[model samples]
Target: MESKELINKSAKKIWQKWSIAIRITPLIILLALLKILTHYLGWEVLELNALFTSLVAGTIFLIGFLISGVLSDYKESEKLPSEISASMKSLVDDTYTIYKTKNTLTALEFIEFQKMFCNSLINWFYKKEKTKVILKKISEMNHFFIELDKEGVQAGYIIKMKNEQNNLRKMILRIDTIRDTNFVDSAYTILEAMGFLIGCCLLIIKIEPFYASLFFTLVVTFLIAYMFLLIKDLDNPFDYSSNGESGTEVSLKPIHDLRKLLIDFI
Candidate 1:
């Protein structure tokens, strides 16, 4: 799988839908309670207060979800543009390859063959765009095996291929940096804002005094910041972390599997 798809698939497997539902359910309940109170509360002496509570509470919940949805859409869109670029390049390559390989045939037969080949190329490009991009990219890598005999003074030859270790390392580092510098997946930030808004709403209803709400709000804010920091530390899965390194093992495992196949073929 391509790196983006692989990470997405892994995320799907790791993060179940039920878990997400559970996390959001509490927030939904809290918002619902605020809505009910604002609509039904006795307003003989506090008509303005009831109006203010409904307006502010509804605004906060709406803003939070809207922000979350926008961020999610942006993240998904960013990935597709890159994939489309890679696939377009591969389609051009395939078409050119077919056109260059001329063979003798009848005039009608040759025309039919040309159409068939072009159609096949188009289908191949469309159906396997992600795999084609990965394959095409790796195929162009300048790989070489430098064998070292007794003395390591360039004793043996360098068997060069398109795929090179340097290229793979560079690609891995780019992905590593993306994961490291991710300010997008700020789940804790969302949670913190939600907590503070909830606290403020409670203070409005006299459930807690404004001073107590302020203190609790600060505590929730700090906790959210700390949790995000923890997630950021883990986001760079390629880097060594408290749990261990992420991509290192998977990267080498593929090389070993390829070596095994080559040995069997030989």
Candidate 2:
């Protein structure tokens, strides 16, 4: 059951229905047209079937290695939203704890701060703004703790909440590192060239029954192109979708759960 759920999530993230097909369609069409031309013109120039097999095996091995590395990062990313959410919830809970005992922390202010920070962070995902803005908002939370300290709230409580805030900052920076950098960028270029060369090899190689060549050409071209695109998207696990959109982004359910806790607390 757990495996099935991960499969479902991964499938959605990798393909997202029409988007995958649309991106690969051009590559497919080019390969298909080349396949047909070779057939009609009877232009089987030095069959590459034996060499093609070796090339494919090598390409697959390389792609698998790169994908495993990317997948490790992605699997780690799947846990981050929950981590951030839990950390954020602790802050809210701390505020609640302080408010209940000392009656000094402002509930309204914390609620507003949570809402603003969440919205801003999502906007950053959407490429609408810079992360510095979000970082600044996080720093602003220190003011609340400062006020708490002044109110004679226990120093331990204030320090703990401050620590939680720092953890949140660390997680966000970790996210920034993943989201901003591509893994094995040089390898991507090599694989892209390899995929193209493999497609060319498929186009030229003649097999028993011209239809067999055509079938393999289309299928192989599509698979290679699709996997390349999927891996590219997988690199950006936090590629969150907006307003009922489906995408390859890792699930943000924990973040939403934290939001619910805040709303209910309010």
Candidate 3:
């Protein structure tokens, strides 16, 4: 197996087990501790200190929230297919036409085209097992198709391709599975959004005595805590991605290499 395949597989497995609270909670706790320290150190008690305190704390929380958002996006990117892009789809469609058509080719040219397509897919998939599995089925179909295209066309090859197509279709369906949110993620996101909104409201209103404002500010902090956990939960695409099938690692390297092997025959 290629190194890229191993990396993707490992990433998928690790992503599957990711716990948002475990990864994100500590940071929230640390921020809370910093706030407490400021209060004890008279940092929040100095002249006109309430305004300064809010600004500093708000800045910290905002940065942490942004980081969480970035991580969420990262996980999503891992789950999606590069082929989902329009340009790549066009490229694949172009090559697929070659296979769809009946044409005369020197054995070497067929093998060359096959190898190139395989290589392109390999780069596209970044060497994941799900892609590997897809390639294997495609190879089986291609081989049978070649046999049928040889000296005589056979009816059985159609049956074989159809069977292979079914198998491939199942694999494609698996890629569509998206996991549901466990309580932690759902609750956390809800809490964080509430906190952000409440905190903004309190700040804008300038609630006096500082204590009342502080209490509301704490609400915002709590929301950050929840968001931290939610981000952790949503960061892995395999289990947490849009589909259950999204998180699996897939690679097209084997198909590319297999196509290269055909060139040896020429």
Candidate 4:
């Protein structure tokens, strides 16, 4: 089978990812131009060196903190799909064992359950289905494991199967939590507020020549606004539909491979 390309985020595609952030460019430029105009009109520009410096310093630190926090979760999310695939593989092996142990019909029924469970995951990861929808399916898979108990399968195999089932449920819910939540809601609020203030500062502060002010204002504002959008895009690794930077998302190939493996069983 052909490999799916993800890491080859060409410069053009990378620029496209900036599209969301670029929407604010016109406004940032307007602010810079507006600042330049104030100089031409001979209006007094506020030159608070310490205040401007402190604000930029504080905001930069805050952005750094947010990036560090969000990255940990994003890294964790990347591993979950592969781990989940492994758990399902183990679970399928247990179910197959039951089939050979003379509970053939019942075991095959459970195999059907496995297929549905895996398919639902692909949909859920795509955001086509909500958390509760997937939770209900997971609950059903759990109960199916219980049915195997009466088949007189060895206690050890049953326990192992149940454990694998638990692992699957745990990882899916983990992904759901990451998808539905933010790294820190209040932190994001603060970042946006600070971003607005910095934009205002860039427009109102006194800098050197008109050209210098224009250069600093445009460059600084663009970096701040771009990172704000990029951080938000990174915070939700499962947001596959976003136009944000490519390859930021956790790859789904493991899940797809698991789906293919399940289909082979059916």
Candidate 5:
């Protein structure tokens, strides 16, 4: 009973880890069952042969396309967070320079903006509810900048500050959009269904040896499951926690370092 409990616990952990791809499991099971049925029945027909062959080819192509799409999305997810952190650092540095060189009072006002911006980013890392609040504060920061302009801040410096603010806003919006976007599209799901159906058809019509068909079916099913899990893991690079030895999980070190920089500068 203890062993069974342990197994169940382990399985639950795995299920939670791969839950993003849970929708595909039923289709995979259906395909496996169909493959097994085809072997058991030993159906041989010319029309079925042509249909199965075509389907097998299409399934392979679809899988390839889906893999490429998933990989591209994974790379983008991994890249965007670092890009945001870098942009934030640049904005902070620019604010510090303005504080030191031009106007101490304006710089002091900008410190409030800096704190709000950093708080927004930290909130984004922890709680999504703070996003709206942070965005509102960012709008208020813009008005503060307008006030600085009215106070006869140099035109060139104001332009630079405005450009930095705009860049930060764009980067934050991109991060928000990417976080909310689904990595796996509807077309990928549809293609996966078609692939499974086709795999079953191919197993039934083409493979003559029952043992060979069974072996291939098991291999194919395992490969398909592994592929789905791989895609799921890569889909959200920020959330992936399964790196084995090399510790390849996406790092928030940039944010931490920036926090330190802010403390020192402020």
Candidate 6:
């Protein structure tokens, strides 16, 4: 078990490193490809006018812009999980406060419900499966609040708790939508095509130093692949796994901390 844990930890570290590297891999690849093209053109091995240089530079600029857009999308994606976590933590705290003040449910019952709701939430965040189960659990929580409302709990407190629950549900739904959405698909397709075109351009160059051309081509290819993998991995930050393990995921530390707080409250 220890060995397995160690391997999992190592794999997570590697994934994190690769994830960071992939963000810039496309630009690096493009520069390297351009450098090779420039060298061959300068050596007169590949006959092309200044027009070709301008075109290559333009293409690099365009691709760099696309990468920037992708990075923007990635940053947006990173915010969502934290948003959900915050909403959840607030909901948990608010629920506990309501329970304490209203006395609609016994401590044991509130704890039991809290445990079930929180467990379902964490599972939903991590497993991202069993939506029916999560929805059902949420319905149960909502129903519990409704029951409290009927039992002479202050309408204001009940309304606040319900609103928190609704916000939590909406955030969860947003997360699910994000998980299903493909933010980077179009960007990736464009990048892949550009990479292919670049590769073709490289192949056409009649450089005498065939090995150098070949080396540069390989590097560009690898870099393009790296970019694709990186974008895909980052597109849905919640869904990626390197070794089919869970720890490489976006940190659920906020939720975990909330869980501890819930335990303390109980």
Candidate 2 residues 143-190, lDDT tens each?
887777777888898889889889989988889899889998999999
Task: Provide the lowest-lDDT 10-residue window in model 2.
Answer: 239-248
With a 3 Å backbone cut-off (N, CA, C), the pairs that clash in candidate 1 are 141-162, 141-163, 142-162, 143-163
Please give the TM-score that candidate 4 achieves against the real structure: 0.82
Candidate 6 local distance difference test against the native:
0.64
What lDDT does each candidate get? 0.38, 0.79, 0.47, 0.78, 0.63, 0.64
Q: Give the per-residue lDDT of model 6 (tens digit) for 120-163.
A: 67777667447667777677776676666677766776677677
TM-score of each: 0.31, 0.87, 0.34, 0.82, 0.64, 0.70
Top-down lDDT ranking: 2, 4, 6, 5, 3, 1
lDDT of 1 by residue, 86-178 (tens): 333333333233334422122223233333433332233233333344444434322111211122312112221112323433453454444
Best by TM-score: 2
For residue 73, give model 3's deviation from the true position in Å.
18
Model 5 CA deviation exceeding 4 Å by range: 1-50, 70-77, 102-106, 125-127, 150-152, 182-184, 198-211, 229-252
Best by lDDT: 2
Runs of candidate 4 with Cα error greater than 4 angstroms are: 1-44, 100-103, 241-247
Candidate 6: where is the Cα deviation over 4 Å? 1-11, 19-62, 106-110, 126-128, 184-187, 241-249, 260-265
How many Å off is the CA of 204 in candidate 2? 1.6
Q: So what's the TM-score on candidate 1?
A: 0.31
After aligning candidate 1 to the native by TM-score, how far in Å is the CA of 26 from where it should be?
A: 5.3
lDDT of 1 at 5: 100
Model 3 C-alpha lDDT per residue in residues 32-146, reported as the tens digit of each score: 5655555556555334346656764664566466556646545554434432232223323333443455342422344454455455444434334355555564565465356
In candidate 4, position 185 carries an lDDT of: 94
Model 3 ranges off by over 4 Å: 1-33, 41-118, 126-150, 173-188, 194-266
Cα misplacement distance, residue 245 of candidate 5 (Å) = 16
